[model samples]
Target: MQWKQNLNHWLHHLPENDPLKIELENYQSDDKLMEDCFYKELEFGTGGMRGIMGPGTNRINLYTVRKAAYGLSQYIKDQGQEAMARGVAISYDTRHLSKEFALEVAKTVGAEGIQVYVFDKYRPTPLLSFAVRHLNTYAGVMITASHNPPEYNGLKMYGEDGAQLPPDAADVIIDYMNEVKTELLIEVAEVKQLEKDRLLTYIGKNEDIAYIHSLDSIKLNDSANNKDLSIVFTALHGTATETVQEAFLAFGFTKVKYVYEQCGPDPNFTTVKSPNPEEADAFTLAIQYGKGNNADIILATDPDADRLGVAVKDEKGEYVLLTGNQIGSIIIHYLLEQKLEAGTLPKNGVVMKTIVTTELARAITGTYGLETMDTLTGFKFIAEKIQEFEQTQDHTFLFGFEESYGFLIDGFVRDKDAVQAAVFIAEAAAYYKAQGKSLFDVLNDLFEEFGYYIEETHSITLEGKDGAEQIERIMESFWSNPPLHIGGIQVVEIEDYMTSIATELPSGMKSPIDLPKANVLKYKLEDDSWICIRPSGTEPKIKFYFGVKGKTAEIARNKLRKLKKLLLQGVHV
Candidate 1:
């Protein structure tokens, strides 16, 4: 069928009361808007389905959501009735229709004779992970787009292990979803009937309590009782405020302030241009609150509270946002040092980081005699490492982090938990404050010890179907015509992750990389600098990650700038 015809079919099939359909109807005369909305079905990648919220299969609506739930239900049933009986947990964030989507998933799964544990209100992504494990559910669903714009929404699935479903399982779920021909056939038990049958359970404070208790275990030094230290936290108008606040208080942080404008679960995220904490603008309100309160530290969590961003007063008393790498290094160093001092550091402990993350984490972990492993960019891979350790190795999992503001300190929750990170960061701040040093000062100390390693991430967004094709072409261009030099520095090695081959340039020796195959390429420079390129899994963007290490910060920054320009030139060609 033609794309337009298929789109029309989908639009007409939508329920009359569907808000998305109504919105589309209002734009019926606009050809461009219609084409954009119905160009393709929203791609469900490793992170699950995320797209604009509107009518049509290309958007995130009640129909697409139900189809995903039905597909998940089918997958669980195929795993056997026992797995289905184990059921699924459902949670939602502060996005539009999040609650409605959660209920729809519950009803759809309930119709398959599988139980559903649905949160009664908004919750963080990590809380959903915790709920999956706490309830011993077969699977979990979270309705959130993380830090995406308010126009966007998404659904993520978690395995019984409380991590996002691994690729192998995700493939099966996607296959089942594709098998769904029509949303009309997606079965859904009546909400009332599902409740009567006890298949749909509304979870509330109990799950929150369990999650918070798990967060308390993140505190490394209970004796760092500098309760007078002031701190400010902001949720960026998302779902994290209450849990983060409670966790801080429970951890004995006496002076915690919240940015009033961004504290609540506002779906619109009105105060910030974007809900993502990765951007400095997202922390503006928090900075204001922090400065007004004379706070020593400011922390912000993205919409779903899976990633954390931090700002600390610099030497000049100006609040500066720390890169994700800086924060990860600080936390890893702090946790290891404190644990070792207390004689509680695990002897066979392991720390995991993404391949694109800062090597500073590896440096710190090695100094502490802990093994550091690198995985693909997503936190699921880190979670996979934790499960691997649990099943086979004696390695006690200590910490895991990615360069993209995601960190998982303890394995209690498989994914990153900003709630847990907030507690530990607060404790670390207090500990440092007791020594008359700020986080910024401690970061410099880390650099002094571990060498100056600087990392930067640049993303080029190419929207729509054509942009996706261009991204593929750019990646292929790199693979076919590999660069011999970057920023006039000799290329030492080239790692083609898709082919699992690491080729040493000078010797022409190739070795296999013992990691999952991903569409990523890394170029190692002679000066120990490197650049990596990978298309974003969830967004319409191609990202370049640059890491440069030098004797001084200035040298590293200069090398990084040159390397970035070279990389951009390569991508453009």
Candidate 2:
């Protein structure tokens, strides 16, 4: 078989004493395991490439790390002397091989005569983004899988604007990656020696200070910064403690408590099933501490600290987890209200959200006279919008968020920032406290003002090569033939992002979709409900996103249940 031939090729090239060779020898007797590892190389997906740690082309080991760095090195070289001199900034999280992979990239990039700046230890993803712009580097690398399971790790690449590479630039990097014949044979420069030559610099405290200073500008309610609220924070066994804690202290919230078990750099993420803030089970420890301390709000950040999960007290004094949509809308309401009162709200302001995000954002922004913009499903597209607004100065970029618990408040950092988000949540909680209400009350009032909007995402996991093909087949089926009705609701319109067209169903009136083409299908129901089906760009699964707006919360919940059930049944994977 071709996979066996590739396996033998890798084994032949690896040295006997190498750690990867030793690992391959142990799995030699198992054909399935070896085939899984050797069948294909890990490709850069939505954010970047990610895989389990092991010894093959499909795995995320040192050699694959070197391969990515090699590709990036060549790309920088092609950009000419200025890019080489400006160099790359690299950082890692608490995951296994994170630091090792980061160092490997530095060495590989330096070996190709490009200067490299690397963190001495683990840092959050946003800091890496901030560092890219702060250091005036041409590119940046963050070694993290960002909320994936413990066994998974990956690298995310950032362009000079500090956003993930858009499709055009990613194509160039992939071309360079494909040209690397033998990854294990790539050479690396020595870090210690490179330091002496001033080609390698370790970044930490200074960058942290500068990043913290930038985060401070996200605050809108100076009067609401009183220490009137009790808060509980958890890093979920990752790298958010120091920065998050410092930011809360800066906001004068003296009653903040930390979930000790989940604090600070634990690659295993021992406390939770998954260190994802989007999941309810991931907040067990934080909620427990919150209940014990009678905290007003509970905040949890994922491993790499880019996404934040929140729990707020309801009128009954029970802790309720806030969906990403709920949290984002709360912040938008608070910021918009404050700015409007202060008369600082920009007349031509814009709020950005992913196509699948809650329509509540549009409702809230519209009431305040701010326009809303929708981007394709990724933070990179949102970042690109911010870059455009900054260059054109046509509109003020107020805030951008995704349904997956990622948010960006300030354009200073061209990515989602839990540090900035944590601060805002704290202030928002306090603002409500001053008004003798809770965060839940604020959301309830919003629902009463606007229509009740509910959104949920569900996915089915499939693995290996066959699973990938299955996902594609499922998407293709939806693209070629879409159902006229789902759960007794007639389909009114269909948006085919992959074809960059929107067709009004039954009538068949077509309009061009200005966004980039992507393999995603969205169905707008006759009742104004919607369902979106798209393959998970960063996972071996297919995701189904459901959205429903009703006159009341109970009505919205029931509609969401029916639509979700119907859509999940149709999704084969």
Global lDDT of each model?
0.88, 0.90
Per-candidate count of clashing residue pairs (backbone under 3 Å) = 0, 0
Candidate 1 positional error at 23, Å:
3.0
The digit string of per-residue lDDT tens for model 2 on 451-477 reads 899999988788888888898898888
> Per-residue lDDT tens digits of candidate 1, residues 495-523?
99999999999899999999889999999
Taking all chains together, each candidate's TM-score versus the true structure is 0.97, 0.98
CA-RMSD of model 2: 1.1
The runs of at least 3 residues in candidate 1 whose Cα sits more than 4 Å from the true structure, single-residue gaps closed, are none
